[model samples]
Target chain A: MDLFISLFINGLATGMLIFLLAAGLTLIFGLMDVLNFAHGGLFVWGAYSGIFVYTWSGSFIVGILGAIVTGFVLGWITEKLIITPVYGNHVQQILITLGFMLVLSECIKVVFGPNSIPVDVPSYLAGSWEIGEVIVIKYRIFIIVIGLVIFGIFQYVLKKTKIGLIVRAGVMDKEMVQVLGINIKRVFLFVFMTGSAMAAFGGMLMAPYSGVIYAEMGMEYAILGFIVVVIGGMGSFSGSLMAAILVGLAGSFMAYYVPYLSLAVNMILMAIVLIFRPQGLFTNAKEG
Target chain B: MRHEKYFSLKNLTFLIIIIALIFFPYVADSRTLTILMTQIFIFSILAMSYDILLGYTGIVSFGHAMFFGIGAYTTAILLSTYNNTMMIFLISIIVGMIFAGIVSFLVGLLTLRLKSHFFAMLTLAISGLFLVVAEKWRTVTKGNDGFTFRAPDVFRDRVIFYFFVLVCLVVVFLVLRRFVNSPLGKVLIAVRENEQRTRSLGFRTLHYKVTASVVAGVVASLSGSLYAISLRFVNTSVMSMDITLDALLMTIIGGVGTLIGPIVGSLVIETAQHYLSGLANDYPIFERWIIFFGMLYILAVIFFPKGIVGTVYVKYLTWKSKKAKPQLPTQSVPLVKDKERFE
Candidate 1:
């Protein structure tokens, strides 16, 4: 029972982080119709920047803010320079963003050197809480809370506000939304920035969780993020969250039980979804 | 009526490329030749197979390496304990084709239903999942330690594995070339050009996509098998996203829709990467190779998006049109019509 609880918690935390990355990824894909492979690069940058600042300042909150700002700057530059030019061309966007992914990865090595950096949890979040022989890592709970909070904020924004309405409507019909008098370019920029920030935040949080940050971690987790997005639905935000949790739990449990199949489990899930629900779990987008 | 062939540019250029590739191992240092030629052949096959989906059928699969890896592993496992190189090769090809066809068919059913970009994203996710499986599923795959096998006799005699690859490539090129020009090939092209219209014509476009994808998968696996033969090695890296990117880059650089583009593109990129990395031992400038690759892709698309072969064909056609008799405008018919559509 304790083992199951630990795996469940661990999985939920990982899922929440993936949800954060996938949220940004799906938003960009839906809003601009641009497939951003560099989304992972942005997430990695967030992890590095947030952790760097956290270590320097010896403060966890400051690290989170730093990561967000780093994501914003990185995203803004990427949108203006790389994404804007290749807005309508899927091939161009993929190539350029993949290039950007490499460039970002290289840049990480340049900034922090080509080695892994050790990440530490805050003092208050380091210890485990034991209840009747069931021990739960405090930091895992903290990450889960952060993920849920972010989801709530985005959900509220998506459902209640004007920006949310534009985002939701834009995902439904980006071309029509453009014809309706809003500057879709601005929306693209906004989505790009938001997505990057969210990805970066995920990175920063994940850095401590993994306890070390490396350049390739972005690509690795980005893969996880992408899987979550696909499993959830491309343009569906809440779907990312739910799918992420499912994936997280599946991975956690699979790691313990059927160790060999754990790696393939996500793919098998994707294949099954592609077979049964290619539209994804929470997606309502029209099929092409 | 049979079109009169005064050596069409595609045929002529393809011949030139084939000849150059054939001479590669002979002229260059054995080590350099082996590495570059082998990489080129592997990617050439990869790019050609990719053309079926990306160029001919118009399904952008970001995770095509999954099939390539499947073939490599299949061949590796088959050949590891078995001695009949020919039988193993044949079995591996069938295994690769069947596996790719089945997986892609199932995946294509739903993801292919997605619009273009989303479809690509699904492939990426699915491939990523494959990587994790490859890395962690150590029992069957030996996990990160990977798997190794003795290099097969390769060509059985003096031809060497490189020449065998060359021969296989030539045969594949011929087969695919014929397929593209055939009725089925035309339908695949039609699907790429306008699926809805083809559907309106009562053709099942999805079936063609799956069929083309299966053939492409088989071809890609052939390359993977050849790669295993070449190196006498197999590892999880065969399924890595890096290989997928390399293949995509080659296909794009060679030209998206052109048949011969991938072959030419692979030769150019792999040779350059080889020389660039050979420059230093420490840095290998391999990272710089990535930089160049990244830069080359953007520059290639921005400046000559049609790819080297595509641009060459266009230029050749343009020059030929100018050289042709000013008296007959009919010679410029195809070129003029294509340009008109683009404009």
Candidate 2:
């Protein structure tokens, strides 16, 4: 029972990180119909930059803030430069974004040097609590709390705000929204930027969780984010959350029980989902 | 009428090129040049197979390396485990191709029903699964360190092997040319242009796609076998994403739909890679060749979207039309109508 709870918490924390990345990917796909493969590049950058600031300033909050700023800036640049030209063409978008992904990864090697960097949990978030044979890591609990808070905040904003309604409307029909006099283009830019920022924020949090950050981690986690997006259903926020948790739990348990299958478990789960429910676990909000 | 002529100018040009390449090993005598040419031939075959999916059928699969790896591993395992006789070498290629065909067929059936982005991501994930399997099944694959094996005596001779691979490249190219021009190929093209319209026309698009996938898989496996033979070694790197990206780059940079374009693209890229890496020995900055490669890729997509051959062909057509005398309105009307109907 203790092992199960510990595994469950671990999975939840990992799922939250994946959700941060997939939420942005699904939203960008749903609203703009643009699949940004370079979203992963934004993630690695967030980790590198956030960790750099954390070490320099010695404040975790400042590090998170730095990461968000970097995300917004990179998001704006990607949308304006790399993404703007290849809009509406899926093949070009995939190729161009893939190219950008390579550039981003290589640039990391250039900037941060070609070595993995180890990170430590913040002082406040270190250690664990033991409650009668049930021990809980503080960092893991902290991550779960942060993930839920972010989820709650985004959920509220998406449901209650005027921009949220506009974004949702844009997802359903960009032309209809445009005809109604909303600058759907600006909304697209906003969504793209926000999605990218979230990816970076996820990367920042993932650094301490993983303990080591490398240039290639972006591609690795990006694949996970893509799987989560597919399983959650593209453009569905809650779907991403549900699917992320499921993948996290599956991975967490499988690693402990069947080490040989851990690497392939996510792929098998995705294939099964693809074969049976091609629309993903939850249909897109727009479609639903 | 031009195509009907057996000895047309185009046909003659191709024949001359083939004859020249056949005599290349004798004339070059340099081992480095021969090796380079052989590498180009092998990759040209791989890129052309990719074109069948990406250009001819409008399907973008990111997991193409899986087929390549299957072929490489099959041949590598067979030759090392058994005797390296000529018969085994021949049988290994066939067996590898069959294995690749089955896997690709299954993969296509499972994933082709999804949208493009979903299909791409699924294939990538599946290929990653193959990589994991290869890594974990270290006893058979020898793990990431890989294993080297001897080939048949005939293949041990570089000159003989070079010609053999050249012949394979030529044969594969001609077969693919005929494939993309066949009626079935035309239907594939129709599907690419507009899947819904083709479906409305009563063509089973899925069947056509699966067929293309199988053909591509078999051809890619053949190249993988050839690659393993050329190196006398096999490794999990054969199935890496880098190999798939190379195919994609070759197809796009040469000319997507043009069968000959991938050959040209492979030549340009392989030569550039060779020179850049060679330069890396002297210049520290050149060590990061992939960064330059990535930049070139981005530039190619933005500037030469049609690729070298495609852009040149379009230009030649426009120039020829400009030079020709204007057609009478009555005559041009039928021509325009014919073109519209054909399209």
Candidate 3:
């Protein structure tokens, strides 16, 4: 029972990290109609920046904040330079974004050097909470709480705020929103920044969980985030949540039970999802 | 005109080019001969395969390497464990084709419901998922250990692989050329230009897409088999997004619609890669193939949207017209001659 409890918590924590990354990805796709393959690059950049700041400043919170800011700047520049030109053409977007993914990843090696850095849990979140025979790490619970909070805050902002409404509106009909005299491009810039920041935040949070930050970590988790987005349906927020959870649980369970297909399990899940429901589980948003 | 084909200059030019390609390999040095021929055979097959999805069906796939990798891996594993290359080739080709078809069949069934953009993203995601799995699953794949075969025999070496590829490329090319010229090809073209219109044409467009997709899978598998045999190894690199992008770029650079385009595209690209790397070794200042190739790609897409072959073919036609009427103007005559110097 304790083992079961441990596995469940571990899976939940991983799922939250994946959710944070996937949330950003789905939001970008939902609103922009651009599939940023470099999304993983952002996640990795977040990890490196967050970890660097954490080590230099000796403050975990400050490290995370710095990471988000870094992601925002990168996102703004990337949007202006790379993504802005290839809006309507999927092929061009893919080519350019993929190139950016490689460049961004390589830049991580340049900035941080080609070594994985160890990041320890902050003292405040270092302990474990025991419930009868079950023990849960304090940081895992913290991750879950943080994940829930981010989801809640974003959900509330999306549901009750004008900015959220505009984003949702943009997702549904960019032209219609443009007709109403709103600068959809600015909105895109804003969403792109927010999404990048969110991914960075996820990476910052993931550093301690994985116990190390490597340049390739972004590619690794970015793939998981992508599968979640696909299974959850592209651009569907609630769908991302459900899909992330499903993939998380499946990954956790399958790793122990069917070890051979462990890596392939997620792929199989995605393939099956694509086969049965290709538009994804949620495609209700009307977009042109 | 003595023949219907001769009535059209394009067909006549195509015939001439085909005849030249067959003869040029004989005159080239061994290294250049093998490399260029391999590029033509491999990329022509890949481009033809890609056309099944891109040109004919209008579905742009960012992950076509999944089939290619699967084919290569299956063949490498079989060939390493067994001796009969023919049987292994047959099994791997079938497996790769079937697996790809099944995956696409399922993916297409679902994604075909979405818009083209969403569907394309889904394919990209699926291939990426495959890459991650291939990389991490260290047991069967030896993870990244990557299996290599013993150099089989001299007669069973590069030349042998070259011949094998030649036969496959010609067969696949002719079959597809015929298919596209047939009623089936019209259905595919119709689907691409207008999906709803094709559907309203009382055709099950989904079935046509699935069929084209499988054909593409089979052809890609053929290249994969040759790649595995020639390189004497099979690894996840075959399935990586880079190779898939190369195939996409090859098709894009060559022009997607024509049979000759990918062949030309691959010839330009692989040669670029070979020469670029060679240049990198000679001049350390130009070490970055990434920047160099990226610039070339950007220029091609931005300035010459028609692709290398398509744009050149257009230029050739314009020149032909001017050459036929050298009486037009000496100024125009110089321009035609100058342009001919470049192609």
Task: Provide a comma-separated list of chain B TM-scores, one per candidate.
Answer: 0.86, 0.93, 0.82
lDDT at position A35, candidate 3: 81
TM-score of 1: 0.89
After superposing candidate 3 on the true structure, give the runs of residues whose Cα lies further than 4 Å from its correct spot: A55-58, A88-96, A106-133, A275-288, B1-40, B84-114, B121-143, B150-157, B275-288, B291-305, B314-343
Better model by lDDT: candidate 2 vs candidate 3:
2
lDDT of 1: 0.80
**Docking quality class, candidate 1:** acceptable
Please list all clashing residue pairs in model 2, or write none if there are none: none
DockQ of 1: 0.35
DockQ of every predicted complex: 0.35, 0.48, 0.17
Looking at model 1, residue A98 earns an lDDT score of 78
Best by lDDT: 2
Q: Candidate 3 local accuracy as lDDT?
A: 0.76
Better of 1 and 3 by lDDT: 1
Please give the range of 10 consecutive residues that has the lowest summed lDDT in model 3 chain B.
B334-343
Q: Model 3, B154-264: lDDT tens per residue?
A: 425556666667778777887888887778877887777667889997999988887777777777877776677777777889888777767867776786666677777
Arrange candidates by DockQ, highest first: which order? 2, 1, 3
Question: Compared with the true structure, what per-residue lDDT tens digits does model 3 show for residues A128-172?
Answer: 988999998999999989998999999998889999999998877
Question: Model 3 misses residue B155 by how many Å?
Answer: 4.2
- Candidate 1: stretches off by over 4 Å: A173-180, A283-288, B1-26, B84-111, B129-140, B154-159, B282-286, B322-343
In terms of DockQ, which candidate is stronger, 2 or 3? 2
Where does candidate 3 clash, by residue pair? A275-B106, B138-B143
